[model samples]
Target: MTSAFIHLKASRLGRMAAACLAALALAVPAHAEKLPRLVLAGPAAAVSVPLIHMVETGALKEVADSVEFVTWKDPDQLRVLALGGKADFLAMPSNVAANLYNRGQPLKLLNISTWGVLWMVSRDKNLKTLADFRGKEIAMPFRADMPDIVFGLLAERLGMDPKKDFALRYVASPLDAMQLLITRRVDHALLAEPAVSMALRKTKSFPISVVAPDLYRSVDLQQEWGRLFKREARLPQAGITVLGKAMSNDALQAKVMAAYEKSLAWCQKNARQCGEMVAKRIDLLSPEAVADSLAASPLRHVSAAAAREELTFFFQQMLAKNPALVGGKLPDAGFYGNAGRP
Candidate 1:
């Protein structure tokens, strides 16, 4: 065909292509960029009770298009989810978060979910302080984890070597340690709530038939931490963190934070109901027992910025004890969120 004829046919085809593109554009939905699914995970602990309540209340419906909430009874499972990039939002021990962040992970702490749940519970009435365990048998669990690390810090602060000053019988798990306590194998145990509450309940059967309030003298180490620091006395325990990918979306972050706080508020307001829900999730204790423990649980939702001083102090203590605890050093300014919203 002649050049002029070929050019005329090409122009007609171009016009037809433009017409088809316009028609397709008009047919497609306006919000075609489907948002990615978000996953929030934590252990089945009281600190995570609020998140569970949030999931139960459909709090994330306002923010997330699709969210999956998964609870693990083991911290290691939660750790894998948090560190392996399997979860978008996760709750983990503050020290683990700090350590991960300091080691150059893109994890950022959103807020403090748990203040301090660790308690020093003992069958001996005289076992009051760290001084009391100078040469007594004590049970410890989850080696190098928060409980073990915290106890080490407490011992060092009390001017005693944990190994030499106290006979700490390390157990495989907190439940194992609690078993030792119930059997009266160890006079003292460093346990977290749920575990503390569980041990207290077991006392009703063995070791003592009569369960008095003073059967096990307990001390809240969060208060002790506050006293030791002489600053923020509350124990800033585990909290929620988001990988860089999830936090890249500012709107999503705000929604997640707000939903979290709202869920936590609802649980705080309806303690008994929340505890029943939590007990169902944990299954280690009854609803009434869980409710009572949840009410007494030292769970809090402090924004990272408001909690910086407390966090820095806590991390510093961990670092002083062992540089590896906080990943050799403290995290940078970016580690703390602008605030886990209002």
Candidate 2:
């Protein structure tokens, strides 16, 4: 062939190849623009269970090359993970999420999955109400945080003082409170699951007798919340938040959230399987205890914006007692990720 003819054919082939490449690019989903790695962090509570499921199931494979789950034992560790930008997604208390957001953290709460996990476990079975435990030394965890704030709000509403009405024994973590219960060191304790379940299970085992110091799922804080606040028998407690760079990626955010919601439903349905999986990650928990906790806890997934009204009420209540609870004031509309959605 002549030189011009050969050059013309080469140019035509190049154009066709470029068109094919463009077509392939358009065919890929938006979430296909994957990140190198993604880190998810949370406490070993029910809120983090779904995240563990997502990682195990490779639910976010399309959004990231690798997905990891890290456990933060306390509020300080959680804050460390978030403040250091170590995690892209985190499971945290709703109020903490609000506090961080109000304090100008570049994070947005995606959904509230843990509604009511706080319960008052006591040795006295006859203890029917929060008022019934007057003057008792009750082991409490996360002193100024969750279960504490909820307890305070309820006590103050009932015209009782949290600090003066009851003897509150502050501890470092829920497990410490559970230990106090298991050892028969305290007659009462406010604990979140699966620590509650673990406590009940441990107390009934070998060395410990079933009758002497058997624990009861005494007054449920959620129940009191409903009766006193005239609201549902649940609280907008804990949920997942997307942070830093991930907040701007809408497609990835949607994928992460959809996976989380689906995983949460899966966990509730397959409690045994979920429990086993979660227990493997958190050595402090047992499969049976996790399963029991799931059954007892009012676990549900409500989008952050959908839960705003209830959250606003909760935040307002907290702000009343302690202005610093929610970082001085209510977080603006932007705090809720993907706001205005149904």
Candidate 3:
């Protein structure tokens, strides 16, 4: 009877050990499953390089399970990717987001990545201001881009129609715009940082002047927008966005917002380091250019209040300009998310 009792006790112990191992195996997978997967669309300009760094340097990995940085050659390509449900998050102009959202596409703005970084570079010594742009051919990227929109607004404020007052030459890229300016094919070109800096560096014969670096500030577009609408109109530039259909869980939405806040904080703290990391990733820019771009670029943290206010303003502008852009149905309070809510 004692021997029988001993054998039973041994069997019980073995069973307990097996149970513990099984529990551990189950727990491991549960932990892994909780991690989030994100696909980010990068901007065409070099400023987007830091976002690539945030992923490569493991800054974003701390918050997300994995991040895939996809480079878009142009705005239209980025829009196509967003529409196909291939991309989870995209950094694009607010207007583009409005266009998508209006078309029944479920996209919400999460944060603003950039503001106004456009520069009107001119080879002429006499072209000192926007007033000098009259009757001059300006090389622009395209008719629908952020630069085009901003320049159009600037022209309107100056009492000139962009299509009629100035000869707008369409260029494929900033480099192409620079080439046009250098060869004297265009009187002026809309250029952004690094490219603007690069163009000036390459052309030693013709000195290029920044007709406007703080163009938004100079023209009072924000104020004008507010005055016209009696509501705040912040320039909707670049930001993080996600598809409404894919975001089903409230818990997941909370996690994404938390991640954005954390990422923005990380970027602000390590600006210089992030710049270096981006330079290495793109392999096109020099370390010095990267550092300067990072310093000059308006990379800032967007508060929840600011994000809400800015998005609302952008949506209102779109509604006024073209309600069809938002499907003729205005965005409800839910559109702003918790960040924008009072």
Candidate 4:
């Protein structure tokens, strides 16, 4: 072939190769770098639902070579995970995130995904409000943490002392409180989502029905919070926090938040399927209950920066009740992650 013909051929081949590479890049996720692996941790709650979905669906495959979800059942376990730098991301209570951040843990709040999932389940259907059940025994979980802090503030707002107005039986976790309710050991219990739905579901199912008393999801604390606190009928209770190594990876953090938000939306829209998937991952929860929890929960994804106002309001409320609840003060702006567009 002549020199011009050869040059023309080479140019055509180069264009075709570039087009092929473009198609390949489009077909696969374009990541400049990927972490060898990532661990997403959370409790067996609604906030963690999307994390499990992300792992099962490989939602963060582009950002990391592998992503897995680990369950941290209680605050101690959550602390251990954070302190030990074992988890890259975590689904944690908003207050706990603030506490950790204030205490100098290298972590940042990514987004608040769990808006309102806490509820007061009771055997007494007549109990309509927080005050109505005064002077009665109620099982509470994670005393001085999240739902407890929220309960205390709400009770104080109503001019009723939490410890004096009601018999607050502190339990280790929501599931423990749930068990007490199901077994009729406690007439009322404060439970978060999935647990709340589980209690409602288990009470009616077969052998448990023989002994378990009929329960009612009576007092919605979020509603009570709004009514008494004069705000929206939702609280910034929980969100995902980027921990340890994940905090430094801004691109990965953004991608992770994007995947989490998309996963959360997917879980809400496809509750039944999401429930089954979550059920497989968390043995304590049932598919039916998970689906019900989704319907009942006011789950939303709000970026940390965008949610700062509401979160500050929440932290301020907690701070007023007990300074230790948020590690003695509101976290600096650095506590919030600049990830994912709200």
| lDDT for position 313 in model 3 | 61
Window of ten residues with lowest summed lDDT in model 3: 211-220
Q: Relative to the true structure, how large is the alpha-carbon lDDT of every model?
A: 0.76, 0.89, 0.61, 0.90
What's model 2's lDDT at 213? 69
Report the poorest 10 consecutive residues by lDDT, candidate 1.
206-215
Model 1 alpha-carbon miss at residue 139, Å:
1.9
Against the true structure, candidate 3 reaches a TM-score of 0.73
User: Candidate 3 lDDT, tens digit per residue, 1-342?
Assistant: 999999999999999999999999999876764558767666645436545765675654644588777877576787788888877666676667666776777767655656545677775665555667788888887555666776776566567788898888987666577667656566578776555655554454323333322111122334444454465443556666667454564455555555555654564567567556655655444455555555555555463246656666665655564465445655554444443122
| Model 1 per-residue lDDT tens digits across residues 17-128 | 9999988897664344335476788765666777777777777764556767777555577667766888888888888888888887888888997888888888776666
- Write one digit per residue (lDDT tens) for candidate 2, span 248-320: 8887788888888888889888999999999899998989998899898888778898999999999999988
Best model number under TM-score: 2
Comparison by TM-score, 1 against 4, better one: 4
TM-score quality measure for candidate 1: 0.83
* Arranged by TM-score, best first: 2, 4, 1, 3
What TM-score would candidate 2 get against the native? 0.94
Clashing pairs in 1: 115-235, 226-233
* Better TM-score candidate (1, 3): 1
CA lDDT, candidate 3, residue 239: 62
Per-candidate RMSD vs. true structure?
5.4, 2.3, 5.3, 3.9
